[model samples]
Target: MRLRKPKLVLIDLDGTLVDSVPDLAYCVDEMMKALGRAPWGEETVRGWVGNGVDRLVMRALTNTLWDDPEDDEFEAAHPIFMKLYAENTSGRSCLYAGVVEGIDYLKGEGLKVGCVTNKAAAFTVPLLKAMGIYEKFDIVVSGDTTPKKKPDPMPLLHAANQLGVKAENCLMVGDSMHDVEAARNAGFQVVCVPYGYNHGVDIREAGPDAVIDSLAELKNLLK
Candidate 1:
């Protein structure tokens, strides 16, 4: 997508900046073991990511999108997963290809950069900091930072407001449809990376403004 030098660039955390499923999968399995359920494995957990921790736990419990775990079970499993995730966050996660270069390019171009993610603040903040990319961001708006998370447009809008930029002048970059839909709903341009977890669906079908393979390539596109 062509842009006239967006005033702000809001990026998604998981699947975009970080391939976080490794730690998430570990936590999911640990939580499942505690609950006496079978481990979902990394492959299954990969497809369940991008939504949120609660949804991921539910998906693990049900093993299918057509069904959901009971609320009581969810309540029981939620904290277990949270505790496990908190202990494991970023321990196995790493940045995706070209993430650092891309963030550097954006900052080098004097663009205001913010990290917007469906991951909760408790997990999001420390992970970014642990990865040494936290200070690179001008602001961070996590899933719990707003009333609603991605696919709701509230988090993106909240980031824009925090950065003092208008939604129309902001650009959203992510790896899933939630990012694209959130950008669309918030009146911002969006680009998607093909490598991220789009809930096991093709991100192209979601129709982002641009489909980029690597974050580093954004340097050439941003003007």
Candidate 2:
């Protein structure tokens, strides 16, 4: 598919630009251990992602102890998870293959690059800084930065507005249903990556404008 030179490009963080499951799983394990619960495997934690920390913690608690965590339990676990996660932010995290070159190529093409992620700003900032790509984006919007996250289209639309671009002139690149749905709702083009986590669902089934195995393919498609 040929894409017009985008005035703005909005990228997702987790499971899109970066493979953050390792660090996420580590935090989940640590949180469970703090609660005296058995640890879950990485694959199990992978299935619990994409929703948000509250849902992730609840899912992890349910999987490990066979009981859903109440709001209070999750509240107690939240800070512990954050503390452990902040310490291990980049311990097991790494950018997806070709993500660096892809972003660089887009920037070189004069596209206004931005990040719209469901991750909280606190975690998102440090993670991007650790990955050494924090400066790549002209704007970064986190899940908590807005009243609503992806699937609501507010964040994507908001980012486009912030970049002084129309939604139709922006491209939203991500690896999950939330991304596709948000872009679709916001009247932007959407691209999906096949290798990222999508709650065990095939990303292709999410119905993006295109599905790619690597971000490098995006350069060719856009060109």
Candidate 3:
């Protein structure tokens, strides 16, 4: 079934619009090296993403998704990761297939478009610009843009507020359970893409309103 046409559309960044794992992994491995540990590589780093830089750094330092590094351990490595990531944010990142087409289609339909992600504002804007899609988004709400990020719904709700749209008039397109939960809490319709990082769990298990293989498929569902 087609979803109601929403006044504002919020898309996630990292795993959804762009495959930033290459860049993130590079930084993660380098950070590990800086801390006198071995690199986790791209495939390993891919699963640790979707949270923000802080969590990603902690995961890299601890080498587990669930474990937390001590404050001193985190403090020692977080800055290294941040510096490394700041230098390589988009060097190897690329937009996913159909991203440009999908965003263009939405713009053609006159819908206000936005990007919401747990990534910090420091990295989000630069990556979007580097990927050549910065102009496509009318507003962007990064993890730090609002007081809280995804899985809490503050970012989505903040994006809606910035776009001057009501919760019911917004739709969020993302790739993880955090997206689904956030959209639900924010009272916005949510859709998921299969290819994003979901910590090895199937995104379908998260029960988004629907799942599409590509952003290009979004238009087909939105009528």
Candidate 4:
């Protein structure tokens, strides 16, 4: 099915643009090991992503999705994760199929593209650069970039403003509910990729405007 086109499109960084779990999982595991805890393997770490580094680290520490880590515990562990992730950000992360082509098609159609993510700018920029897709976005709104991040609509709205496009006239393509909710809140169209992480749940349950198997399908779905 074809979907309405938008003036601008914002992409999510972690699960949407790249499968950063390998590196993220590694860092989390390493940090856990340093803290004298058993490592949380990549499979488990995958479910804890999409929020942000702070949340990810907290989840790793508590071994639960919603519980908060103790102040002293979190303070000590956060920096260890920061260092581990920084030194190995994109070593194993990779772009999914057709990411480049789909992005190229959007630019070819004269659409403005931006990257919005709950990740800190420090890791987002380097990861995108390492994946060779950094220059593709017109703007990047990170977790720390605005007062709020996804699922609250702040980052997406911020990007639309930076790109000089109306929020309702933009599209958000991502993998998780955070993307779907943010787009809905921001009054933008939304699409999802089935292959990306969605907290171990199917992305279709989030009710995005469309769910495509590949990024290349943007050419088929969009105007």
Quote the lDDT for 147 in model 4: 93
What is the per-residue lDDT of model 3 for residues 97-191, given as tens digits with 9 covering 90 to 100? 99999999999999999999888889999999999999899999888888877899888888888778999999999999999999999999999
Candidate RMSDs in Å, in order, are: 1.2, 2.0, 0.9, 0.9
Better of 2 and 3 by TM-score: 3
Model 2 per-residue lDDT tens digits across residues 83-186: 88878877799999999998998999899999999888888999999899999999999999899999899999899988799988999999899899999999
| Residue 206 lDDT, candidate 1, scale 0-100 | 96
> What TM-score would every model get versus the actual structure?
0.96, 0.94, 0.98, 0.97
Residue-wise lDDT of candidate 4 within 1-223, one digit each (tens)? 7778888989887887899999999999999999999998999999988788999999999989889989999999999999999899999999998899999999999999999998889988999999999998999898899999889999998888877899778999999998999999999999999888788899999999999987888999996
lDDT, candidate 1, equals 0.90
Overall lDDT per candidate, in order of appearance: 0.90, 0.87, 0.91, 0.91
Better of 1 and 3 by TM-score: 3
lDDT measured at residue 131 in model 3 versus the true structure, 0 to 100: 95
The reply for model 4, stretches above 4 Å from the true place, is none
Q: Give the TM-score of candidate 4.
A: 0.97
lDDT of 4: 0.91
Candidate 3 ranges with C-alpha deviation above 4 Å: none
Question: Which 10-residue span in candidate 4 carries the lowest summed lDDT?
Answer: 160-169
Taking the tens digit of each residue's C-alpha lDDT, what string does model 1 give over 1-223?
A: 5565798999999999999999999999998899887888899899888888888888888887647888899899999989898899999999888999999999998899999998889999999998889999999999889889889999888888887899889999999998999999999999999999887788999988888888898877875
